[model samples]
Target: MNAIRIDIENVTVAYHGKVALHSASLQLQAGTICGLVGMNGAGKSTLFKAIMGFVQPAGGRILINGLPIRRVQKSSLVAYVPQSEEVDWNFPVSVHDVVMMGRYGYMNLLRIPRLSDQRAVREALERVEMWQMRDRQIGELSGGQKKRTFFARALAQQGKVLLLDEPFAGVDIKTEKMMIHLLMELRQTGHTILISTHDLASITTFCDQVVLINRTILAYGNTSEVFTAENLSRTFGGSVGDFSLATSQLAPGNQEEQEWT
Candidate 1:
């Protein structure tokens, strides 16, 4: 078993006087891939934000390898890939520029790219197969390409932990397979990966651990133990109906399947 890389201790986050995530906590170990499953507005993103220090928790604390986020950030211990919906794809930026942005944390105040930074950017883009289109406008790429571009940005950070939100949302099958393969490889290298996805099949397919959430964490543990029908039904509430425990699959209960699945 890998050592614990992420620790969340009874964290509570509120936005504009409304609590988003309350008393949420979990520990993620290095070299493991954990899935964050929840209904919409269930604080998956809030949990990610709290880990990245994007939001000040209303209560409790978070630690990376036992150090506070502030202390670990300087070491680039965590990297984030936000959901596509949160990005402005129309912004005038090239694929190479975006990937290079990840290296800014390691650069001087002027943010000029050094030889090492350039090498890191090139390697990241190449790893994601986006090097061929390094000069292309980010908005002009296909959905999968856009996703890969940002994924490359995260890779350029060379962080120990990777936080990806809805990575498979709009990607093609090929892209999905590629990402899964890459994530598995990263895990072998001792990178702890956290993914927030609506894809139920994927949770059982790849994640070693699963975190079920609905505003607060409902259950979290090894995939088979925590991803049972009972836990999923509770996490998704009235929306989740059928589950093949054998496969850890969840189907919606609504007359029509919810848009998320």
Candidate 2:
């Protein structure tokens, strides 16, 4: 088996007095893409935040390559791309500058980007096909372009583990396909990726493993084993029959007409 790159062991998270996650545990092997699936407010983002060290767990711990998250972060072994909505588009930074921020982890205290850093930034941008627009302001680009810029930043970070939250949300089909291809390429190069997404149909298509969660982990394992109707229903809280109806209702044809809860 490949080495474990990310290990979340019985982690619990809370907000104020309410428990958001209850002893959730999952392990991600290196060179694989794992999909984090759940309905809205299912603690998917919370789990990602915990792994990224943005939230202190109430219990348990997260390990990156057998080391603690903080140590892994300091070594630039992990990179995160938050949901687009969480980002401030009016930050007044160029695309190249935003991508260059990934190199800050490797820079000195003065934060001066070296020639190697510039080369890395350039290569990342080119890989995502955003090099031509590197000079453009972030706010000026379309939704897909913004996503590409962030993905490029993650690539430039040169991290072995990548965490993304709702990266495919609100993206066009072409853009979604492009991102999926990029992720596959990254996986081939031995990068471990965990992407939180609501597109259940894409799980089988893109992920080698799936972790289903609702307040706590409902299921976690190979995609074929965990993404079944039964597991999805347990995660989403409905009968298999209801799940089928709900899934059909949320299909691409009806997605624009109805809002997903």
Candidate 3:
């Protein structure tokens, strides 16, 4: 059996008396890609924050590699890429500099990067095909380029797990494909990844597992098993009939059939 990389046990989160998540639980295996699917306010981001230790859970716990989240975080076992809207695009930093920030976790108080850090940053940028634009200001790059730069930063971190929120948003199709390919390669390299996205059509195509959440976990399992019409309807609060019709029209017939099969 594959070792579990992430384990969320009956976690709950709330703010100002409004419960964002209630008794949510999930488990992700090592070296696999899991897609988080849910509506806009279904507490997907809250769950990510809880696992990252940015938000304290009101109940239960989260474990990484059988250790507490805080312990895992201290070892730089996880990296996160937040939603694009949360970023300050106008920040005056070069692409290379932004990527180098990933190495800060290993740096001292002076924040000076070492030779090894520089080599890792260069390799990450080259892997993402962004090395040539290393000196360009972040604000001047196209949306796709900006996304790639952030991805390169995550790669430079060399974390065992990656959590990405809407990594495909606002990018062209080509860039989206590139990101997906990179994620798959990362999984093959024994890196566990969890991505929150609304692109339902790509779930079966790339993800090894799918998690459906709506204030809590509605379904979690292999992509081919949990992405059923019934589970999707529960997550989206739509009728299964409506979901099937919509999916049939929006996705390729074979893809839709695979999701249901």
| Poorly placed runs, candidate 1 (over 4 Å) | 1-4, 243-261
- How well does each candidate superpose onto the true structure, as a TM-score? 0.90, 0.90, 0.90
- The true-versus-predicted C-alpha distance at residue 195 of model 3, in Å, is 0.5
Rank by TM-score, descending? 2, 1, 3
Q: What is the Å distance of residue 194 in model 2 from its true position?
A: 0.6
Candidate 3 wrong stretches, greater than 4 Å: 1-4, 240-261
Query: Model 2: number of clashes?
Result: 0
Candidate 2 lDDT, 1-261, residue by residue in tens: 134477899999988767878999988888899999877667888888898898899999998878888876787778899878678999989999999999999999998999999999999999888999999999999989999999999999988888998888777787789889999998898889999876777778989999998899999999988888888878878775544465554433322112211
Model-by-model lDDT, in order?
0.85, 0.84, 0.84
Across 1-261, the per-residue lDDT of candidate 1 in tens digits comes to 234488899999988787888999899889999999886678888888899998899999998878889987887778899877768888999999999999999998999999999999999998889999999999999999999999999999988899998888778888888899899999999999999887787778899999998889999999989988778888877635564442233322221212221
Candidate 3 clashes between residue pairs 3 or more apart in a chain or in different chains: none
Which 10-residue window in model 3 sums to the lowest lDDT?
A: 252-261
Candidate 2 ranges with C-alpha deviation above 4 Å? 1-4, 240-261
| Evaluation by lDDT, superior candidate among 1 and 3 | 1
**RMSD over all Cα atoms, model 1:** 4.5
